[model samples]
Target: MIRYRFGQDDVLRTRFAIAPLMELIGAFYVLRRPERYVVHRRWLKWAASRVGDLDLTLLDAAAPFGGPYWPVFVSPPPREPHATIEAELSRVRETPPERVLAEITHRYPDRLPAAARPFAGDPAGALGELVEQMRALWDAVLGPRWVTISALLESEIASRARSLAALGSRAAFADLHPSVSWEAGCLSVRPTSKSATDVNLAGRGLLLIPSAFTWPTVWPRIDPPWDPALVYPPTGIGDIWEPADTDHGALKSLIGCRRARILQELDRPAATLELAARMRVSAGGISDHLSVLRRAGLVTRRREGRRVVYARTLTGDALCRPST
Candidate 1:
């Protein structure tokens, strides 16, 4: 999905997402997952500058905030926004999927992770990898612990829509983004894409990535908004953006770590060293991969004071569909 659009009032929209962003950096954040966290921060930084210019253009030249484009959300109705949006899009009529995708691709690179766009030469293959990479990214994010946070935030934002969905109304956002919905009694948010500009980044791979802008991407059916506005950084900020591809090849496990198989092997929570023994990997190596998985939302870690324990998240459990 690698969708690059978001609602104007996304719940996670932070004016200063930079600080929390800094916390998740380094090996603990990077190698754990592949492109997601890797690309997200760059997008955020680039997009930050873009938003100021976009808002200035919109609020000043395009039209007033109250015109057709600006829809208010002061206690809006459940599922109403999504449904209304569908109708509005219908009013615009169906544009060619290729054109729609192209416009998004052209606009998104600056606002999204540079990895999102497929490498120039192999656009199709790059797009497929991008989508799949993005989906993998979602699997890591929107999982259990995240679901708890998502639920809390949804309650704060989409209290009514969530309530109505429970009572049965189309697809709930939870169904699309399992991690965000992994928690019981949590509210799910579907994408409205209002005020959110679309960037195709071209959905080439799997996992239904909702936005490349947000790392550990998402799997919302309606593609919930993450960033408030489409951000575009000025050129020469870094490397010239290229469409993402597995050109360098998939990342190697940090020596002796096969955390996925280890997690797959476990039936219960296990100590790092214990799983390390089972996986035949060195304790240090297991620790490193566990750290990676932990960041990827694949596995989780908790300190029993001196010792740390790792386990799979509900999203992981669902994904693994482990035998009971």
Candidate 2:
């Protein structure tokens, strides 16, 4: 990587600096609000210890969906957000993604030089292709207003870019050779930490997915073995509460495969190796599905050192009409 005098590298450098700054600020923010973290930590500790998705599901069921974080209903996390570890996902259902991207580019020129940089070469083409794909995704789920989705969309992309730049490919996200994305409303994030050198890439399964498009948006991917229908219609304050039965049309379209089926199997909860063994597949296979499910809001991932555990969502339990 060649460094230009205040060129793309500088832009990446600034982003790297800012993400940690926000993270640090957020950490301090939580520390200052120790009570919030404490209350959440206590509950999360319980949830984490509980083995199956049923127990965790009960917690989500017990708690009001939007009590602590409202943005999730507006823009759910890449994974389920219980009382602990909340992330902001703004709703832009009323704005156009193209327009939003324009506004963002207009606002932060240095941070986003992609818009200003002249289109040329493969990188330029790849970036353009990625943007176009995001635009399509925004349109598919959000329709016209998805144009505003570009801001949040680009935020994810830029954040990843910065993380990779700062952390280095190995120290950064694991799925390096191939990138992740959401195609035709199907999430496409991949987690890979296959190390080639001294890089201690945890490869805790890279997830480029987020938490906004849970069921109603992604049920099409669930299969019998993976997600045995067990849920109740979600009747919350901000979401499409007690909505109609599952949209069979959409689900039918979501082509479930080995990975999708395994996710359905773990609709409860399982460790990395357990899920892999039960599904008769590779750990990476389960990790991939978990990453996608977590991103789609169907599953959740929590960390314990180098290993991050996985489980299904309670709201989804309601959707599946789980008996117990």
Q: Which candidate number maximizes TM-score?
A: 2
Q: In model 2, which range of ten residues has the least summed lDDT?
A: 226-235
lDDT of 1: 0.34
lDDT of 1 by residue, 217-292 (tens): 2322222223222111111213212222321112224223265566564435578889877877798977777777
The alpha-carbon deviation from the true structure for residue 29 of candidate 2, after best TM-score superposition, in angstroms, is 33
Instruction: Quote the RMSD, in angstroms, for model 1.
Output: 18.6
Regions of model 2 farther than 4 Å from truth: 1-255, 322-324
Per-residue lDDT over 135-234 for candidate 2, one digit per residue giving the tens place of the 0 to 100 score: 3332222322111122233334565566666775443334321332322212232332222212111222222322222211211111211111111111
Candidate 2's C-alpha lDDT? Answer: 0.33
- Among the numbered candidates, top lDDT falls to 1
